[model samples]
Target: STSSPSSSSTSVETPVETLKSYLSELLNNHNAKRALHGVSDLVWDEEVYQYAKSFADAYSCPADGMLSHSDGSYGENLAAGFSSAASVVDAWYEEIQYYNFNNPGFSMATGHFTQLVWASTDKLGCAYKDCNTIYGRYVVCNYSPPGNVIGHFAANV
Candidate 1:
């Protein structure tokens, strides 16, 4: 068997490339949903990104396959076992099924979708990790001016 150097290099991607892929897909998915509601596109924030990365790095996937939330500083949506950015976002956006536009209030089931499209929550920072657990990878997306506020969901989401 013969192996070419080019083939080996091509098979391995750099961290920058990986990060680019994750972040671009994150923006694309989030902005597409936000556009439907006339909300502004989100811009990446270093602080938020670091927050997410730190959380992802320190996260200990619990036995129940349950994910945890961040300090109430930023609106956060999390998913474990999802690999690609699209899949992570998709898992969260899937919460839309339980959303009630008529009631227009916060529901634990729909919190992810509402946070994804929150009109005033313009900043975005996300991180994804391939971890050592049955859950596989984890994703953390932080939104500034966090969404899902009890009284404000009607207008913001």
Candidate 2:
């Protein structure tokens, strides 16, 4: 006896069909300018990064940066590094792991910090002021369609 016709139909998804699967939500376009409320323009400049690294290496918490006995440990060294970095900028934080010895990035550089201040009384956290320095941290932003897209298009036309 012959078996029933084997299933031969196969489903082929098309790009358009796949595209339809993607549901997009229009995130209300809060004016980027408005969203940038109280945004600090601090950026990581090469000079700043270099200076920061040097200062940190030159000075840092001793106990963390170096090994010593209970008397005058690397804590002093760590503090020194932070102090040096802070001298350049208004504020700085020290970051130190094992094997100190003037480790860079142990100190927080205000130059690399950014603060997004909303209209509310609350103050948003400070972003790395120098995140975008040529040799510094990375900075990211959520971009939206240009506010004057139509104007740009019209100009092109």
Candidate 3:
């Protein structure tokens, strides 16, 4: 007639309680606190979330007046489909420059930059000067160019 320990009631942790517990543990640990020194508070702030949402809505892909294809494509080809790969590379360079000027702090990985160069070379059947120029810029930046220029280049290429 006695209830076993397995039958005892248990409390489910709410989201807030779980987050508080995690934060408490993180705060108590010196290493975790040090690692999260600058961003700990922003992690849970509602205002930060709102600001991020606003920025995303404002600047995300499919910018104002841009069309989207039924198949989910952006419907705007960076360089015309029939254009040669060299032309594409040139377009990408100009695009990257524009992005760098517009956005203060963004960078692209060297691996990706090299991949784009190789892809352009493959498509063009020869290496182009744009490849060396873009790659050199990437090297000068230690393989990460400021701004989302690389992203723009990749998309266009």
Candidate 4:
């Protein structure tokens, strides 16, 4: 397998076109699901994109093939193994099955879905790496006014 990893979606690192492509792809998939659930659509933010890019770049895929998260103030959703941007979003959204609207709270299995469709989270930015490591590839999305706060998932998600 190839080990020449590549990255994009930042002003300094890639073309504006690359940024726009992912911005459209990630937003379209995310908003479509959020809309179906009665939440406002999310807008792309460059700063948030940078946040995701930083994490994707700094950590990358390791030999152990495990994923790690950057525990910052923002909310994040991490995914891997998928080859397309939309597929990544779908995988995150697929967690909706585990979310209990009746109970409405944080859950390890459902956090990604909740974060994806979280109502108050209006801004989003995502980045990924074509890592040739054991893990291959991974996607990272950072949300502003992050969701999944304890006791608030009932209202926010």
Which residue segments of model 2 deviate by more than 4 Å? 1-37, 64-157
Query: For model 4, how does the per-residue alpha-carbon lDDT over 49-142 read when each residue is reduced to its tens digit?
Result: 8999888887646656578779998899987778677888899898889988999998899989999988999999888775665455678899
Output the TM-score of candidate 4. 0.85
lDDT of 2 by residue, 1-157 (tens): 5553333212122364432221010011112222433322222234333433344333223233342222211111111122122231222111112212333222223111111111221111111122111223211111111111222222211
Candidate 2 lDDT at 132 equals: 16
Question: How high is each candidate's TM-score?
Answer: 0.84, 0.20, 0.19, 0.85
- Model 1, 1-157: lDDT tens digits are 8887754331222399777887889989888878888889999899999998898777765546678787759999988777677788888888888998878998888999999988889899988766546676677899998988888878986
Worst 10 contiguous positions by lDDT, candidate 2: 22-31
**Against the unseen true structure, what C-alpha lDDT does each candidate score?**
0.81, 0.22, 0.26, 0.82
User: In model 4, where is the ten-residue run with the lowest total lDDT?
Assistant: 3-12
Clashes of each: 0, 29, 1, 0
**Model 2, residue 61: what's the lDDT?**
31
Question: Best lDDT goes to which candidate?
Answer: 4
Superposed model 4: Cα runs more than 4 Å off = 1-19
